[model samples]
Target: MSLLNEKVISSASEQTQAVLSFVRAWLRGEETFEIHTSGSTGAPKRIWLTRSQMEASAQATAAALGLEVGMNALVCLPVQYIAGRMMLVRGLVLGLNLIVVEPSSDPLAALPADLSVDFVSFVPLQMKTLLDVALVADDDQLSSEARARALAYRRRLEAMRAILVGGGPISPGLEAQIRQIAAPAYHTYGMTETATHVALRRLNGPQASDRFVPLPGVETGVDERGCLHVRGTMTGGALLQTNDLVALQPDGSFIWVGRWDNVINSGGVKVHVEQVEATIETLAAEQPELGLARRRFFIAGLPDERLGQRVVLVVEGAPLAEDQEAQLLRALIRALPRHHAPRHIQYIDRFAETPTGKIERSSTLKLLE
Candidate 1:
């Protein structure tokens, strides 16, 4: 019997048929596959990836993380996207046992209590959700069953050889929680173009870092505008230019700054929206009473008659009271440069999100209209 005929695939839910479909195609030696980009920044588009390119990417990941054949790997992300597709490719190319589950905010919730997975990947939201449940405080109000489940999940997490977190940014608060877990977690940096992640940043332990180190065989450079340029086996020896601005390090590793397209020129001062969002997140972590950090928000530029584009803070949730909003504004103004401070705060019941769960800033802004 072939691997696809295994009990796992036969017993899988209908949601996991996509995983079975992809594996079947790979086993048949399909040469090219179509992948869709996560349109967090712009419109989503389709790109073609060769089987050789995906195999190379999978091999690089296996070597970087010391993955071996027969180890159980979990596939819990959307199969239509590259992150999830690459996870499937890695399993097929490396001869690993795959545990397929429908994508959710908490992928591990569906697993059996005794099941152990050696490798897994998650979006930031999923990672945060898992950590939140696993790290629930002892004294917190919760039923005995809930606490037991939390403990079980924590054990499952700690047993993993590697945990790859990508698809979005990991906030400071979430990073702190990740440190408490024993599992070796890494923040991956890459996109559909590079076949998931080309670089990774350690999220915990002594080796934890803010900079992303390129995997073996990958090269990094910056263009004149400071945007990142990637090349190596993953790109098939062709240089791939990205709009992501980064502070290139003396070594091959680099620190991701923000996107060039996300720059806001407010009254002549160029403000990076990511920097502003990061600052707010940090401030929220430092000063929890401000109530800014708990909410999901993004900085955007709106048309302005005088400044050409005015910076504004777009938040997801109910509107704050007059005094509370005022206090939040004061905190932001104190921490940010005068021009970087958001001129106004806009509230929406919910923010738009891409299929991969990234905040759709462009589409979310349209909600204000």
Candidate 2:
């Protein structure tokens, strides 16, 4: 075989090397392999997964999406993360022609204009970047040359049959933009423990669902704490209880409530951080002072002498001025019920995020300490 046929990738980064090593090992009949969790809620840890498990996951995903052999898939996420790694697994097992690209906030920028991408996966950050670029393309104020490049980006996205957005929350603004795309964009829900997503909520189209419905062969319900639990072939039939709170419906679909860890028991009232954060997202788009449309924020619990724990709002970026703070507080109070109101406000120069782009609510709040 020629040197090129030897399957050597020269000048590749360490991450790409790791990806190749793992995939090669699996292809070589390796049974069990260790993978790390992104650890958005806790310390990172390694766990073993089998080739059979990954293959089963890939088949499920392919079946769910109606992916055929030799279809094209673009992979732009870090190969280390589960979402990114699964894209590779899907390519190998589902016989996709994988077009791998370096991790970026704007991976589409590197693609060929005429490339036919059937499916693609991105975090909310990447989606936001693409949406922002698409907006610029439609703006008549831009130079013709600039608009042409941006139009190419938008066209590439519209050409995809499916787009999967996960790894973090999709803001309302991004979701609205996704609706305008011709492709059916979906919000995926799952973690490394589940070998990627076991359920999907369509973000666009007439069949768009408010609840996350599990893929075939997956079952979902809530544990005693109202946290989500999975029992299915995807989970190896072992019940995998998650920290995510959800309203598990009788129809086997689930409405994600929030995270139990971020819930605050303030004066015996239960306050969900995720719910408040969703409200904040809406306000960010409406109010100029909050600027949360581009900024990030989360609700946290702080110890209080009387209430035991008080709901606190933690915003990303420099601290707000007294007037700005007051405006934010008023907006938040108006939207949230009395018990759900944040008792305190804090700011971080930058919010801590997991490698996969999930906001580390607890650790980010710790920065204020």
Clashes of each: 0, 0
Q: Cα miss at 93, model 2 (Å)?
A: 0.4
Off by over 4 Å in 2: 1-12
In model 1, residue pairs whose N, Cα or C atoms come closer than 3 Å (at least 3 residues apart or on different chains), thus clashing, are none
Instruction: For candidate 1, write residues 121-162 as lDDT tens digits.
Output: 988889989888889847368788888878888888999999
RMSD of each: 2.1, 2.7
lDDT by candidate, in order shown? 0.87, 0.81
**RMSD to native, candidate 2:** 2.7
- For candidate 2, which ten residues in a row score worst on lDDT? 1-10
